[model samples]
Target: MFNGIVDVCWIPFAGFISFLIILSAINKSVGVRKAYVNILLRIFEYGRASIESASKENTQSVRENVTSDQNASVQPVKDVDANESTNGATLITRDAVLLPQAQESGNDKPQTLKKEEFNFDFENCLDYVKSGVEAIIEDDVTSRFEAEELKSWNMLTRTNRHYEFISWKITLIWMFGFAVRYSILMPLRVLVCFIGVVWLTVCTAAVGNLKDGNKKRAIVNNVLGQCFGVLSSAISAVITYHNEDNRPSSGICVANHTSPIDVLVLMCDTNYSLIGQRHGGFLGVLQRALARASPHIWFERGEAKDRLIVAERLKQHVSDPNNPPILIFPEGTCINNTSVMQFKKGSFEVGGVIYPVAIKYDPRFGDAFWNSSKYSMMQYLYMMMTSWAIVCDVWYLPPMYRQDGESAIDFANRVKGVIAKQGGLVDLVWDGQLKRMKPKKEWKEIQQVEFANRLKSD
Candidate 1:
């Protein structure tokens, strides 16, 4: 599996192999291939220099802050100016004495404007060092890449036939590989599931926790779920009806989270209660709006009583024939589509059909960390923008019936194993014994017959 993987992944690796074969055929040395990697090396150098510069700037800022703190009681060293504060100048500390607002009646100290402190003095020093050391050591890489692209595109647009023949062949290599690998081969089937994440976080449809008891946006909610799933997936998502008329009746829906987009994928047009974290500041307002529109909510998993109240409310949604299924994440925690995590036991408690869905991210944002990590949302956004390879896989298992004695934990485990198997996270890919989930019913029924025969003999 890994062998087939390396061959299909990334242009540089594929290009290297092609170059080597041609050289070997003509008995030429492989050293000429080194010229192609200069761009990559230059990029690495630029990234390293940027990081080093940022660290030095931060260290200097911190030292200045600490020094100011030590002399907090001393006389004001410099006149305060608004714009200077943002550029590593002295700042208003919490302990500083504040003058009353100018809006207050009878206050008349006029504001004074100070001469600008030139940024060029500091910037020139950095640039001089960069040009003398960094630039000399490395080509002006960013500009070089831009220039190269311009040259390549300019060459491609030329009408000359000889150049056109070679250009067409070169273009085909990159496009054909990207199309077949990302579209036809692996094709980011799971990336289709990214919409569910967005739904939970950023859809305008949410409106926030419902106050109207029921204002009627069920169909719209469900439609958005399917639409976002389709839009986010790149391949349009189709919502198949579970009941006779291609309409999904009451059931429990479970999914994985990779990004805020998942929310849009899961809740679009569905007349059901969507649940989310209770405490994210503005979420309270949004939840209130959704509450007014429908009965969706803000849930704090840590609060047992609040959750029980929410769970009871969920039962009402499931009981209502007009409302759609309760969509949920069986795994309470988010996970990178790596190894499947243990499923949370919330949905099976709702009873009725348990819709088991296996969510896997695709190439685009598939490696997205779902587990708890210290990374900021801003950082995740930065990576998502530059990398541009996130895909999600959603495999919906047939709705299951919950038996009277069966616990939610058992049902969740069964679903988790099926999802794990279907998503290809475990087994032949990882070279480990796959943890077995519940066996297929057909296999179980056949196995039971043999077990009964053995018991009869005993």
Candidate 2:
């Protein structure tokens, strides 16, 4: 009976999946995903209310059991006058305050110089101690590298706040969610992703052989973007793109780096020539496939000469009116989606219209930040695949030009500020590479010099 059920249903199941893939590849939705998302939102609301109610109940019970047993101890007061009388002594105090001396009425000679003095105060060190402690507890740079904390539980085990066992209803709901995500959603998503990748490879390979022309470029862009859209659906990505009118036609496009999928997310909407270090494995396959039909710059991982080559290639690509805009993450590293870190000045120095794009991911659905230090590319992809969904907002800001007197660093910062503001992300001046590197000696020296000046002023 089981074999018969599987045999009868498998073919239809495969056919249905194939149909969904076609719809995704064509960038068409039947509102099924929208409806599914709505259902999930309702469930999330119910779970949030349940968790809050359970939390209140637990707090009340805890308070009831928490007895106010803090004992108060008092000591008898002694009379200062009585003690003074007993000792037969009178206390005399003198005012230690110093007043500025008045200038002599008619003296031509300058008053004797008073030597300046410096006294070390232990209290002055307390501020540094407090700052150190605060940094240890929660520093800006370190916190930006970690997973963002959610206000409420999202019903995922990875983000567990022990809310599942708070009540029987919540526990049951969690179990159901677990089964749905792992047993149903994950397998289906994997199958869809596999099909999308295979389709991209075959499609790009055929298109690569065609002569490079306007029609060929147009077809390649559509095919590549649509293929990415299909892959995005594998993770149930619900992307809301804003200000599409400002989308880049050509030149340099900059954005905050979060996850590898940031590329996929943006590419789903439009094609761009990607820039990054070449890799092996799953990413390598995708890179090779993309390079077949598009103009992407993938350099060796640790090549010293790659920078000059990349810069030259960048200039040549942007100079051409025919090529797609070069998409560059000027941050040079992935930062947790909570903040936008320092933008490298290299891309800004290239001298072209800077198209700033902002991407903000909804952590309640899933964490989109890829902590490369903690997880490998494959490991991160697995987490994304198992996640509930990838929901993000992309904003395309108006093209900005470098001011006449603006240096590349200032130009980069100006662009970074715009992206951060649009994305509702913290604007940080710290380099994102600080995640793996120690603080620069110059940075520490600057702080030290500031501290010395502060001490002198005090």
Collision count for each candidate, in order: 65, 0
Q: Candidate 1 on 1-458: residue-level lDDT in tens?
A: 98777767866755754454334323344443233234333533443344345556666676678778896544334422211212111122221111112111123333333444423334324433444464344422212111111111111121112322233443454355336444542333333223333443444445443333234354345434443434333322222222233224466776554445354334432444577767453346445545544556566756545657867877877887656566676555444344455455666677777665555554322234422344455454333333323434455566667677767666766776666776654211110111223333443344344333333321
TM-score of 2: 0.86
lDDT for 83 (candidate 1) = 18
Name the regions of candidate 2 deviating beyond 4 angstroms: 1-5, 67-127, 304-306
Evaluate all candidate structures by whole-model CA lDDT and list the values in order: 0.44, 0.81
Residue 151 Cα positional deviation in candidate 1, in Å, after optimal superposition: 32
Worst 10 residues of 2 by lDDT: 81-90
lDDT of 2 by residue, 1-458 (tens): 99999999999998988898888888998888778778877877888777766666766655555533433433333322211211111122212111112222223333232345666676756666666665565565777887877655778878775878878988998899889888989999988889889989999999999999899989998999789988988899999999999999999999999998999999998989988888899999999999999888888867625567778888998999899999999988888788898887889888979999999998878889898999998889889988889998999999999999887888888999999999988887778888899876555554565455445533
What are the RMSD figures for all models against the true structure?
27.2, 13.5
Q: Find the candidate with the highest TM-score and give its number.
A: 2
* Model 1 deviation from the true structure expressed as Cα RMSD, one decimal place: 27.2
How much is 57 displaced in model 1, in angstroms?
40
